[model samples]
Target: MELLEANGSCSNGSLLTLSCLSHRVVCQVIGNADPVWDNGTSGNSWVTLLETSYGFYIGLGLAIFSSFLIGSSVILKKKGLLRLVEKGGTRAGDGGHGYLKDWLWWAGLLTMGGGEAANFAAYAFAPATIVTPLGALSVLISAILSSYLLGERLNMLGKLGCMLSLVGSTVMVIHAPEDEEVTTLDEMSSKLKEPGFLAYAAILLALCFLLIFYFAPRYGQSNILVYLTICSVIGAFSVSSVKGLGIAIKGFFAGQPVLQHPLTWILVVTLVASITTQINYLNKSLDIFNTSLVFPIYYVLFTTIVITTSIILFKEWVSMTVVDIIGTVCGFLTIILGVFLLHAFKDMDVSLGNLPQVLQSGQQAPVTRDDKNILIEVDNSSIAPEDKPKALA
Candidate 1:
């Protein structure tokens, strides 16, 4: 059973909370609950979930919570981000902020939120492994949105990445594991009591924070603080929503007493915090990077964070063949690399095929040694100044 750590870094606040929600926590909860299915329940596959009252409730609850968190994060992050944008612009010598700004910001947030919500919903219903790869769809979504709304063009590499993501996600979806019988509340809770589970959760949480510490200020093309905050908030909420669904399910079977469970409280709070963080990151990223590149990478990292945690928490691969395990990991890594390559294009200033034409048009483009690096750094330098996000296109 997966056992996530719970009690280290209690001083770290949300960092601690995130650690507690790891897949190990899920396993610990299940094991502790000592759950028994409604009889004739199959293995832990999705199909089995449909055969019982508890499974349905649990799955449904997760789905709803995931949707809620995703939706909330999108709106909150977009609004918060826009405010930052306006503040930045006014400070940076851009003036005359008005209704158009609000309109544009809200509109973008809503659209982005909807897309994220769909992806989160998918995650709740399926395993993170399956849901994660499917998130590649956001690439295509962002591309279309950029072309139609932002007037950005996708060159050959961009188009290739989008198509590959689509094809790969489709394949992964078809091959995802089926659901099984619903596990009881006691089973989930009991597992949390284990030492290993708590240890693992703590370790994962530490790693997450470490990444936040290192990455938020160092490397991203966008605002680091904003990026880290956004990631933290989104992850916190997404994880919480997932836990809340689990609690609600557990409560349904073993009396409403579980409604007041500690895990439940953790879930709710995490969901809110996570959403807040996501908005912060999105707003900052929107300023420096194209939506096509930023959103996909954000989602990719989000998925990676969850699924990687899940692997240890549940010991999810105990039943898998060696080949299957290797293949699954390789597939996930490929998607990550593909996403990186896809986003790399955004770093470049000129579109590949149109480079000659643009030169002929006599545009004094921001040319330098590796124009992409200049774009990323100049944009990044403004991140900490707290301003309205500049459009990168």
Candidate 2:
């Protein structure tokens, strides 16, 4: 019986040893699973989520909403400026800043800011290739609204242009590049340092200087292209800066403290400076030119430059198939064509001869059915009432 008890005691000891080993293994696993690992997993999951179809849709929806707001803001701001001008404020070229006091101008400015904010958010989830071209929708909206609300006439060709822009926008959205994974400011910095992008930036700066110092003084008022070129060139840098700022903000919210980086601050400053420049020049263009003429031209040029800059900076086409690239190019061209149509046909209804006809005497008046066969009595006062014609029966 003592031997049996010793064997039973040994078995109990072995069981205890095994249980302790199992407990240590479980503890080691729990200890090794650190927060860093969990955080990395979460980060990856978040990126995956942003790269999904739903994220694209979200970006697209925001872009559409932004376009509408921006379009409406244009009309409101223009109207406000007209009111200010009527109130003895100088024109935009004559150093008139009197629109600052106009409540409608303030409202329009706020609306535009909201639209820009929405656009900035969209850059966080979608590629610029998609967001920029979709801006054509704003032009479309502005054209249609101007026709009804602002009394701008949209001819048949202008209508065709709107349709073309819509089709092009649809195609671009379908063929847009997938969002690149940009988790940190360092990644964005690396992109900015790419040789191609740097060259593009240099060229843009040089052109902007030439236009501002030389061309602007000479042709700025008469040539819409001069002002538009400045805006478009500056716009490229602004868009990139906006994207960088957005990424930094996203990283900061993810517990990364990306805003502490110097690059983030640089981008922030750049975004502010660029946007200010854009607003100043865009307002000048609006004040000088018709909204219908300015918007399409501005959109076309701005979109072209922005897309080119995005492609160079982001290498968005690296992963795209050749067919996709071709489709994107075709879509962009179609949008340009549409813009051209809108611009070319905007004044079709207004005839230069109509003014002369109105000023000329003895112009033929419209004949009514009742007056078709009526004979009129003629008075010859110069003939001393002897040459007067009697009324016909």
Q: What is the per-residue lDDT of model 1 for residues 129-230, given as tens digits with 9 covering 90 to 100?
A: 554454454445545445554355556556666666655554444443434211434444565556876786676567556656777667655454346444
Runs with alpha carbons beyond 4 Å of true place in candidate 2: 1-53, 75-109, 148-152, 218-223, 283-293, 350-393
lDDT of 2: 0.67
Error of 1 at 291 (Å): 8.1
- Per-prediction TM-score, please? 0.56, 0.69
TM-score of 2: 0.69
* Model number with the top lDDT: 2
Model 2 CA lDDT for position 57: 79
Q: Which window of 10 residues has the lowest lDDT sum in candidate 1? A: 384-393
RMSD to the hidden true structure, all candidates: 15.0, 17.3
Best by TM-score: 2
Worst 10 residues of 2 by lDDT: 384-393
lDDT of each residue in 1-393, candidate 2, tens digit only:
122333454332232222452353211111223456432336456654554547667778888888788777766776776687678777543556677788887887787778777887777767788887777676678779888987766766678889998888888887877756454678778888888778889999999999989998998889888887788888887888877777766666566767568998888788778767776676566556554466567777888888887778877777888888988989998988887787656655433445356347445423222121111110100000111000000
**At residue 191, what lDDT does model 2 achieve?**
83
